[model samples]
Target: MRSWAEAERAEVGRARLRVSVLVALAIALMIAFVGGIAYVVMVHAQETQVSRELRYNARYGVPGIAPRCAWVFVLEDGTLHEGDLEVPRGFPLRDDIDAVHASRGSIERDVKANGTEYMVLTAPGADGTTVQAVFDLRYQLLDRAHLLLALAIALVAGLLLAALVGLTISRRTVGPWAEALARQRRFVTDASHELRTPIARAHLRAQVLAAGLPADQRTDLDALARSIRGLADVVDDLLASAQLQERRDRVPVDLTDVAEAAVVGETERATERRITVLLDHPGRPVLVGGIETGLRRAADELLANALRHTPEGGRISVSVRTVAGQAELVVADNGDGFHPAEAERLFERSHRGPGEGRFGLGLALVREIVTGHGGTVEAVGRPGAGARFTLRLPLAEAGLPVGGEHMTGACP
Candidate 1:
């Protein structure tokens, strides 16, 4: 039990770790995306500002600037003349030369060897010549990078705060459900213990009276004894339900052994009803989890159900085998079949078959026991056809693959 509890806690912890990792990754991506956009916008804005400044400086030559008109030129015959002197630079242009030339606005090139950017603009000169200006732009790029770093730090702090809040909220939401389940279990354990005394006494009294009654009164006494037996079955179911609610962990058992025991017990009980019991094993031991008593009681419930519904000479077969690596126990009978829809509510407490007195809680108790053992129980029946009750239990660790089979899709 302790080991099962520890395993559940470990599973929860792993889920929490996975969620935290996903949250951290999301936060990182958000920071990177926002920071990258900010950096690009800052660089473009700085480049536009430098272009405008250079254009204004070119149009008015700034007063007292040397070479203000010295390098101003005219182009004729596809050749440039600089102030009536031969042009030193070409009329067209060299792409890499760090010289300013002008058309509508001045254009210039300024290349730095280490860690700097440059911008250029060309404009129409005042004397119908062209002027250009250039300026370094490395400072603007560095400023944007620093701003992005600060923003990212703030966002990371915010994400941490949000994650903490989310964790607290989730814990509070699920805590009540956990407590309620625990309380219900304890109640079942206590209630079953209290109810057992009277039921045992009643059974004993019935047995005593049956032994002492004369033949003339035996018929009446037999009816009374049958009623007592019916009551005993109900008490048994209640006790099983209590056990299931109390133990959240499963106790391992061998299904083949359980099926063998059930066959013997059912055969003895059904002798008076003329019901036949056939037991089949796969010849291989299939290990599963559940208290032996609990599993037997569950199987007995199904057997009793089949005996009651099935006509005389109908056969009941109990089979235990391995299916998809899990222990599978099936109880099938050639009984007057049931409605397919009823299969779902067949295990519900207080449900019964048509024309049958009241045997609803039997299947319900069976389900509770199977579920508590970390197994599953299901009923399959169609009208006018035989019925089948199937139980599946997870395989022991020794029987599982390297990491153990996943039970997610085993049952609802």
Candidate 2:
């Protein structure tokens, strides 16, 4: 648990970091998009210019006087005349020349040879022959390569510069949020802590009175005691929710370990009610980045909720594993299932269902904690069926080395 002052610092630090990262990402994406467009336009223009040069050399140039980096060949009267220059090994594409001569149609294609690309065109000549033109594309290819390298360098520099700019901007942009969080969190934590003792005392006194009263007269007193205890639980949950923003001591924790621990904690309760508690976890760790205490609370809340709703002798299943790159913990119970419509509403603060002796704060607190760890929680259930609660957290970079502690039991 973090003190109010430490929580304030963590919240402010996170706010600034979030703003800085978002700004840097935005600028980096913009740079990449603009660079891509420029690269595309340059490539298109170069291709068009190369095609024009090939056409021009094919039409006007003689065999020996072809343009630089270009060769011209003429086939006339079934005799081939090559340029005086040393022809490339694959010159005068014979197939294209024969095809053009026979069909009297133009054939244009790109060919790669000699470690470079060539733009080749064989067309019917006005002088009763076939003319072939080849243009070496090495220089153009080199230019494009250079452009790509330049863009890569620019992108890297832009990212660094954007990060620096973001850092400078975030200090000012996150000021209001920092102050607001400090003020609000300080009050919530303080008030919740202050009220907890008195509430606990009142609850204890009511319980004693209800225990001593005659059975018929003690009904309302027991209800009052229960309500007071519920109030204490709410206050405790609020305190936990307020403290969840602390980013300190966030380490890679085994989600399987957390889930198993939660299940073990509820085992006594389950057995007392003749309910069976089953835990199924992987042999290896399902690691997630989070404050272990908060993550444990989230797991515990789900299991406790399942136990509370499940009827005596009913079963509860707790599972932890890696799913879709996330560490997932699921708690399911075959007890008093809720209506499907209330699945979403169950997490709303203060929303109470019929016969539910809670203020709907536990699941909400669990959601808040999981969300703070960059995770998600969901509820699924149907009337007369069972309810399932799943919690998912982004997996950490493989788990840190921790002593092996595991539990596994299949649920019937």
Candidate 3:
């Protein structure tokens, strides 16, 4: 399974690839459309110029005026009239002359002979004769071919340029997200490290004071010790969650053992709070491939969250089982639940409920750890009812015996 960072990078790469492809396609299409229109307009203008020159040569009888223009005069009886203009051979044929005479009006057509193209025009002459003019289209056709080649080259270059630009834009857009994630991870690591010294000193000082204090003053010291331990746990969670993002090791870990261990770890806190904490699990192991330490921290976070929310005398249960080839670890608490709409948001960093007395990183850390393991975690509950957090992980193919034991501990 891919780590969280790897998965996020993959998603970003896919998005960038899509954007680049779309941008290049759009640019290529626009270039092709514009080039096509320009080509048509240019070709039409050249053709119009040829036709106008033909008309001018026929009317003015310009001799040797244009090399490619050929004109001949023919009588109404379909007999050719030799004129001053030198007509090219194989042009304005007898058939063409006859067709003009039959029409008895202006006629325009294209003629191809000996692999050469010509635009021909026929009109009635002044003395009851017909005049036919032809213009060569070879140069114009060559010009059009050149235009097509240029357009193709421009299209290819434009697509390449657009692809480069699109890739640059995509990287620029996604760079900040990667940087922010890195900075957050760094902050978590730094903060966790910075907090350890003070937390250890406080814990040691509290222990010394509790040892020296009389029985009457011991209760307050114990409470202080608990609060310090909770802070230390929070610090440890912060560090673990930050490191989990980069953790790539995986092994067959029995979630049952992780869950049972978490419940056993929280027994003292549950007893102090006067809350009933129960652990229910199948006798068999529920194996999953993941970082055992991270999974244990996730289970610990869930149980800690429940212990925090549940009221005195309220019930909290941690259950582990397998369902449909998936390992499920569920933590349910009969506490003052949050608003239904806020269930999803509760897992966001630093998001705390009213009077929850938490920094709100526990659930967020749990979610991060679970997702890094290719698993999912969700919360469900309503105000005045209980809350249930379910975590599901893909189960290993075969159950890996882990400690070969089960925890059925319930603290009163």
Candidate 4:
């Protein structure tokens, strides 16, 4: 049994380790790639410099061509004499050489003689004439070695900085999610406790009503029944919302059919209120991927909310239309609209305005349903002006006829 925090940290650590290893490998490869190229280029440049120096020296010998010079040995054959010139200190000189010979052509090679190394360039001058130029690359080698070391240091520093930045970003990003999870757990606990109380009270009230009381108990029983219903409705809404949030996949829904069903249900309930229902765009079905029950619930909540707020005889209009690959469900009424102060918090769970026994969960449920369907619900109404609730759903498929006869019916 691993603690949640420990498990999360371990997971994060593993992820960070994986990312760091990949980044380190990439950085190492990059450095090696660049360093290998630089080494090759530097070696080539040093060789070029040595060749250029040799050419300059070959043109002018001794002190004028080179600052340091030395004579090592002499050789003779027949009527000519030849000698070897030692390279200056810190300059490359032939360390491996065969016996100096007087011949028609010249030979050049890097040789070690007497434990000293040299780069010797030899060529024929005239008939039986030979010359050699020697140079050392100790200083060039040391400079290249230092440069490679510096580049490696810089590369390591850059990799460390990148790792630090990555770690910081991961921590910052996951912090909010951790806090939200904790809050959600608390909310669930609180909601469960709240649910238990109402249910228990409703059960007690039901038992009392079932005990066969007198007429005096009728009013109390009715109030208890209303409370029980309200509690049940809230519980049902909470469960539905949770299910919607947890939905992993979506399916296409016919908006026109869903709208007709919602309107019909609201109409039945609004019979006592005498709210007029106006249905527009009665010929076409607009299809989109959304939960039918959620959509219908949202629509009903909007219509019922309107009827509740609107005065009797006030015109309540419901319209559905398809436009530009989207379906719009608009519900409006001719009554004083929402107050400015409540506009921002209208869709927040359990927030209500100035009204008796008004639990502010209806609009919140509406918002949840619309959001779960991958759509947007907006309220555009000002104080003293009739409010409009607009639901937008994406239309299904391409070039579908907006006037298909599949959509037909008024709210029940």
- In model 1, which regions exceed 4 Å deviation? 1-113, 116-137, 175-179, 196-254, 260-277, 282-290, 301-316, 322-327, 333-412
Per-residue lDDT of 73-178 in model 2, one digit per residue for the tens? 9999999989689888888899999999999989999999999999998998877889999999999999999999998998899999989989989988988777
Candidates' RMSD to native: 9.9, 10.9, 7.8, 13.2
Clash totals in order = 9, 0, 0, 13
Q: Per-residue CA lDDT of candidate 3, range 203-268, in tens?
A: 878888999999898987977875676567666655655664654346788888898878877888
Q: What is the lDDT of candidate 1?
A: 0.63
- The TM-scores, one per candidate, come to 0.53, 0.56, 0.58, 0.43
Worst 10 residues of 3 by lDDT: 403-412
Candidate 4 lDDT, 118-193, residue by residue in tens: 5566544433334456655556667788988988897788678767755666556656765675566457546854
Arrange candidates by TM-score, descending: 3, 2, 1, 4
Ranking by lDDT: 2, 3, 1, 4
Give the C-alpha miss distance for residue 65 in model 3, angstroms. 11
Candidates 3 and 4 compared by lDDT, better number: 3
Candidate 2 CA-lDDT value? 0.82
Best by TM-score: 3
The 10-residue segment with the lowest total lDDT in model 4: 403-412
Worst 10 residues of 2 by lDDT: 403-412
lDDT of 4 at 342: 68
Q: What is the lDDT of residue 322 in candidate 2?
A: 84
